[model samples]
Target: MLSLLLAAAPPALAHHPGADLDKMMGSEEKFFQIIDEPAAPPFELADADGKAVRLSDFSDKIVVLYFIFASCTDLCPIHSEVIADIQRKVNATPMKDRVQFLAVTTDPVRDTSEVLDAYGPAHGLDAGNWMFLTTRPGQPDGTTQKLSEAYNVRFEPLEDGQQMHGAVTHVIDRGGRFAAKFHGLRFDPLNMVLYINGLTNNVRKPAKPEPGWWDRLKVMFL
Candidate 1:
């Protein structure tokens, strides 16, 4: 519901207007393509164990949500690596307990539980706070893929058995609002971590102080 944008003057910014989050986002704000949409569409999908899991299951934590299939040899692999980089960083901090990384497969038929279970470790993703979720048995095919489309990602099946889809990392704030996104695999992963950190703390870190006259004078003298 709130859009996080950076303006020329911090105080004049709109949205959550002048909150600490605004301060923290600062120049790194460009990395987050903030959304002006409703709460993320809720869905009940199964994890690797076939147990039902919903978006609300992570209600108390910040979620880095993305989509991928194990067989793709293109952007999906790089996308997972990017998320893994951010995941490793988040896990190293206190935010680890407060953050969750979810990878929903677009190719549910080929990405079975065994494949889903092996995908994370193969991609260097830690298991502690991450899970590879998929459609459960008896569910219609492409059920979870449809969920990706709901998030504005398109999935076109190619004749080669691979999907043609754009890469995006969706950031869901603690309460399940589809708060922001990092579009494309080219964006910096650190920015993603900072955005999650801001969500975790509910405040942007204060901006760094500018150099004082005394410090400037000392620099000039030295």
Candidate 2:
């Protein structure tokens, strides 16, 4: 199934990496939201260990980024599981080093370093190419949540300790271009992988075929 979807992808056209991929995904993958923006919204947050990590730090790698909190009992867990599945598929391929997965916690107040450390392994996320990020020390508790809004996603706090939000998987191309979004956990994981493969290939439009001798002769005569 994965191979078929990849095989069906349009041949790289002359242009940026996401151009052809966006066209193909628009036609075939309903869940994909093509952003194609020049620059993605920049962000600066802390990793589990309190090291400052900025979006610019990953300028050379394709980033698969998403938002989630540790305590949500609803879609967050399912979303992480879906990310885990995608990560597994991505790790099995040569694209592993070319891609990075990031999960940012919306509820940083309760998601301590301990919780962040355990969340990835607990959800089958590979720490080798993935990182769970939280708000930096002294930053407002709602910092990360506010950042989510820059990506057009909202994580609303509720009285029950659960936040209301939608599931969105953001894919940023190398060099910080906002590529696209895979909305919802129901998207076919293979499709996401294939899209990443397209980006990694750095596919460019094939050169136009030169005219044959007969065509040249015809052109000369006409």
TM-score of each: 0.81, 0.84
| Location of the lowest summed lDDT over 10 successive residues in candidate 2 | 213-222
Which portions of model 2 show Cα errors greater than 4 Å?
1-18, 206-222
Worst 10 residues of 1 by lDDT: 1-10
Best of the candidates, TM-score: 2
lDDT by residue (1-222, candidate 1, tens digit) is 011221121332123212445344445556557673558878888888898888899999988899999999899999999999988777766677998999999999898899999999999999899999988778898898789999989889999999899998888887787778888977767667656755776643344434342232122112
Model 1: number of backbone collisions: 2
TM-score of 1: 0.81
